[model samples]
Target: MRHLKYFCILFVITIVFISGCGNSAKTSKQHEGKIQITTTIGMIKDIVNEVGGEHVAVVGLMKSGVDPHLYKASQGDIQKLEKANIIFYNGLHLEGKMIDIFKKMAKKKTTIAVSKDISEDQLRGWDDGTEGHDPHIWFNVKHWITATKTVRDELIKYDPDHKEDYQTNADAYIKKLEELDQYAEDKIASIPEQTRVLVTAHDAFGYFGDRYGIEVMGLQGISTASEYGSKDVSELRDFLVANKIKAVFMESSVPKKAINAVVEGAKKKGHNVKIGGELFSDAMGEEGTPEGTYIGMVRHNVDTIVDALK
Candidate 1:
């Protein structure tokens, strides 16, 4: 009876050990099959999802309307970076202070700088003579379409088994972008030539204005950390009064104080200029909205500019 009792105890222990081993194996397999990806901005996350479809799990580091230039990755973000199989960033110092961290990750992970693929000639520099390329390529639907293709190609290189699906999805998204580009052209054309001047708090709109032929002016330089001096406000007020500019624009990521300064300055000079509308400058709209996606964001920007300027 004692021997039989001892045998039963060993059998139960063996079963428990085997069960635990099985569960661990299952968890390991799940982790191995899962592909983790991180993108610098919400717009890039949208593009990656469009190409990756159901194959990838993506995380966007920057919140909507958060200035990428001033963004600092938290401890959670660092963990995400360590686990990510692939990473994507806008590059061109868009993530201003975060550039060094991204460069370090590029050495270890499959990091892709989406905007780096754009030609240098197409890029515009910040007003301070800093040649750091403008990182807002999504403003131009054609340029975004090209960047999406580059993203698709990079994703496929990492996950070749889903190449066909990625290519198909990217092609469809590109067609949608082309349609968006046409719509932008039509909408922007409705605005009178003189009203096409876009003045904002910072120099973020150079790419958009250059793409659509609107003249862009900003009270501050590209970096939001830079202070807007009285001279900057005075000069802008002069330009507004001289050109009879009807509207000045504010950015979602920037404080309204700078824009208010422009308005007050213009008012002091006897110019009646209205604040055009809130433009999605450095970042996009809230998640789950139409402006959340890259195409939707640009379309909203075009509509906002036309509605105000026209």
Candidate 2:
């Protein structure tokens, strides 16, 4: 019986070891001859897919409706980062929680920040005397164009053999981005200047407002991690009532309760404020949807804001 028990243990150990090896081999084969890219957000993932084209396999750690400000990397994410040939992220403390992990990965892998190329002159400062520029650079289509070029340059540097393909793809993508930028500018201009105020749950649209010629207000600060109280709500409520702001937008990644509170506060004060629509702030829409892609999301936001505000 003792011999039988020992034999059974050995058999199980052998089976487990063989299975583990097989899985590892399969994982390795999955990225064979392809640049395995792990990106922090869907925006960066879209840029990689556009620039890398058929040569790279890209995976995004944060999907649609994910708030990157508060996102923490999991053990699975760590493994994904480990397996990646290159990693792309939005720096400027956008992925605040994962900054340390990114530093560790930079020592071993090609970890690139797409926002690194954007100059400080183009970035917006916080209104609350806080340090750090706003990290939601994609809201401004022109700023996103800069990010696209950064991805293109990095991919070409890493995979020089595919430099021509990367450059061609980037040219096509930038053309589309330029068109999107024009569309946003035109649509925003149609709204009356006073009625062009964009109020949302958070201050994610400072860059958007600056680029598109609209005023922006938020109940919370730049990062959703910041807290807001009744005093903040009352102040915003008073402003909305005073300005007669027609709509307050909600972010897909942020909770609706805060905006709802603002809207309700306005109603109590005899100013009717509507929840304009949910905008893709920190994240994009679902995959395969029109808003899933970066250009699509921008168009959707422009149309939605125009329809509601104008």
Candidate 3:
């Protein structure tokens, strides 16, 4: 009886080992033709799509209108992350909740923070009574140009077989970004300086404000995780009234309640402030739509701001 039990135990161990090796081989084969990449947000996914082109298969965890700051991973998301050959995120606590998971996965896979390439001095602080640098660096086209290079370098490092393709894609994208930068500058400059204030739900546009010389104000702080109190709304209403600003914008990912409060407050003071439009703040627009794309999203925001403020 003892001999039989030992034999069975050994057989089970052998079977388990063989199964593991088979799964490993199968995974390698599945990812042989193209790399499997997972990114935290649509912007990173879009960048990878532009740079990786046909050489990579990418998955984005956050969808349109999903706030990354408070997003927690589901079991399905974890599975995708585990299966990914590489993971990219706009770090600096942008995806504040997913940082731990990324750190844990870093031990086993290639995980990169794309925004880390930008220098600290170039980053702005969260004025909402929080510490650390703001993670919305993509708001500035110039900053995004640098971010594109980071993605390109990572793609080359892992998939040197597609070096030329990645480089070409990056160069093309950078040129488009340059054009976009010039366009934003011209449109924003056209808006009279007195009406250049950009007020939104949260302080997610520091880079945008700094880049284009708009005075940005948010009822809430940098992270949507923090609640915007009544006082914050009151203060923003006062700011809008004092500056004679015509509109306050809504973000796709953030709720419009805070902004509504500002509107109501301003209304009581006889200042009419309309919702400029829904701007793609933390997340992009729907997939397969122009607003769904990074460049399209930025253009949409710029156009909306210019139209409302002009």
lDDT of 3 by residue, 34-142 (tens): 9899999999999999999988889999999999999999999999999999999999999898888999999999999999789988989866566788999999999
For candidate 2, the per-residue lDDT at 253 reads 97
Query: Could you tell me the TM-score of candidate 3?
Result: 0.89
| 71-168: candidate 2 lDDT, tens digit per residue | 99999999999999999999988898999999999999999998899999998886668778889899998999999999999988999999999999
- lDDT, candidate 1, 51-118, per-residue tens: 88878878888888798878888999988888899999888788888777888998998988888678
**Where in model 1 is the C-alpha error above 4 Å?**
1-32
RMSD of 3: 8.0
Instruction: Name every residue pair that clashes in candidate 2.
Output: none
RMSD after CA superposition, every candidate: 7.7, 4.3, 8.0
Clashes of 1: 0
Backbone clash pairs for candidate 1 read none
RMSD of 1: 7.7
Backbone clashes per model, in order? 0, 0, 0
